[model samples]
Target: MDQVTAAFDATPRRDFLPRAVRRRASYDGPLGIAAGQTNSQPRTVDDMLRLLDVRAGQRVLDVGAGSGWTTALLAHLVGPAGSVLGVELEPELVSFGSGNLARTDRPWASIRQAEPGVLGDADGAPYDRILVSAMADALPVALVDQLADDGVLVVPVDGTMLRVTNPGAVVTAHGRYRFVPLR
Candidate 1:
């Protein structure tokens, strides 16, 4: 099995969800969380992670980390040597996601509130792998700029999923997808 599948097995989605929605953890579809956000669908998350092709010991930034589920999964794929930073726009989700992340043994991963009007964690730029769970009408140049040389960024743009590779910026379309618009 691939490492992404292993991460899913090791990190349960239900752990990141509120108790009210835990029963629907296996639903495969997105579930509503606080601040009117949704935990991304499992299949979509898997696809994004696969496209990211994360390696061990690489730094990753997770955009729109609604529940910290994908953040934890990325942490698992990167292993102990790597680190993951999950930034969320919603204050409620920041606390909720951070709390869920704290339950895991992946000390290298963390969730924090995103700064208003910021596209991504520029202060923590040059991320080896970046996973964006939100949709943007246009490809976010700011995020692409934050990628390290040869870094990979998987994001949804204008309802289509895109895999962006740095150091030349090769872009490939995966398929149609839906997510909350990037703030």
Candidate 2:
């Protein structure tokens, strides 16, 4: 199986889901979380992670990390040698995501709150791979700037899934998708 699928299989999706929707954790569709956010559908997450092509020791950033499901998946992909930083705009989600992540016992990954209007984590700049779970009206410059040379960023922009590489030098649209707007 592909690395993305392996990561998905290893990580328990239900662990990141709210208790109210825990029964539907294995459902293929998105489910509501706190702070008016919804976890990205399983297929969408799989597609993005495949496009990202994460390695075993790369630094990754997960933006709009609502429930930390994707973040945990990334952590699994990166393994113990690598690290992942998940940034959320909502304070409650930061706590919720962090709490969910704590159960994994993976010290290489963490979730924190981002200031309003901030698109990515500047403190963790030069990410080897970046994934944005929320939709943006246009490509978020801050996120692109955070990419290392030849880095890949998978994000939803204007209803399309866009894979950006080489620090915004190359952008490929991978068809349509729905996501909550990035705050």
Candidate 3:
């Protein structure tokens, strides 16, 4: 298995899912989580996680945290010295994500609810990596602005998976991917 799949196996996406959502764990389709949002597919989540290129001691921001699976994975990838913040637009999702993340062994992972479209928690500025879970037309400027000078931003843009590293260089996949639209 590739590193992403290995990570998934290590983390077990099922463990992060709520009881109501566990049945859809292997569906590879979006499933409802807390609030009105849906958790992203495991394959897509894996792809994004690979593109993130997370390293130990880096801070990560997970936009549209949903059930907190992606956040948990990132927290594991970055290890204990690194911190991860899962931000959701709905307060209830924030609570749900927190509960889900609490089960993980990583103590550096946490959830924060904020207005949709806003990027990093201003209080937690300068993230080394940012992963936007929901689909979007383009990289939100605010999110790009929040990146640490050496950071990386991974998102789906223009029907393709793209990575935007600090200094504004964009590397897009030659293929297209379908995802739930960004709110």
Best model number under TM-score? 1
In model 2, pairs of residues that clash are none
How many residue pairs of model 2 clash at the backbone? 0
Error of 3 at 78 (Å): 0.3
- State the lDDT of candidate 2 residue by residue for 1-183, as single tens digits: 988889989888999999999999889999999888998799989999998999999999999888889999999999999999999999999999999999988889999889887779887799999999999999988888999998999999999999999944599999899999888
Q: Rank order by TM-score, top first?
A: 1, 2, 3
* Residue pair clashes in candidate 1: none
Model 2 spans with C-alpha error above 4 angstroms? none
lDDT of candidate model 1 versus the reference: 0.94
Roughly what TM-score does model 3 have, to 2 decimal places? 0.89
Best by lDDT: 1
If scored against the real structure, what TM-score would every candidate get? 0.98, 0.97, 0.89
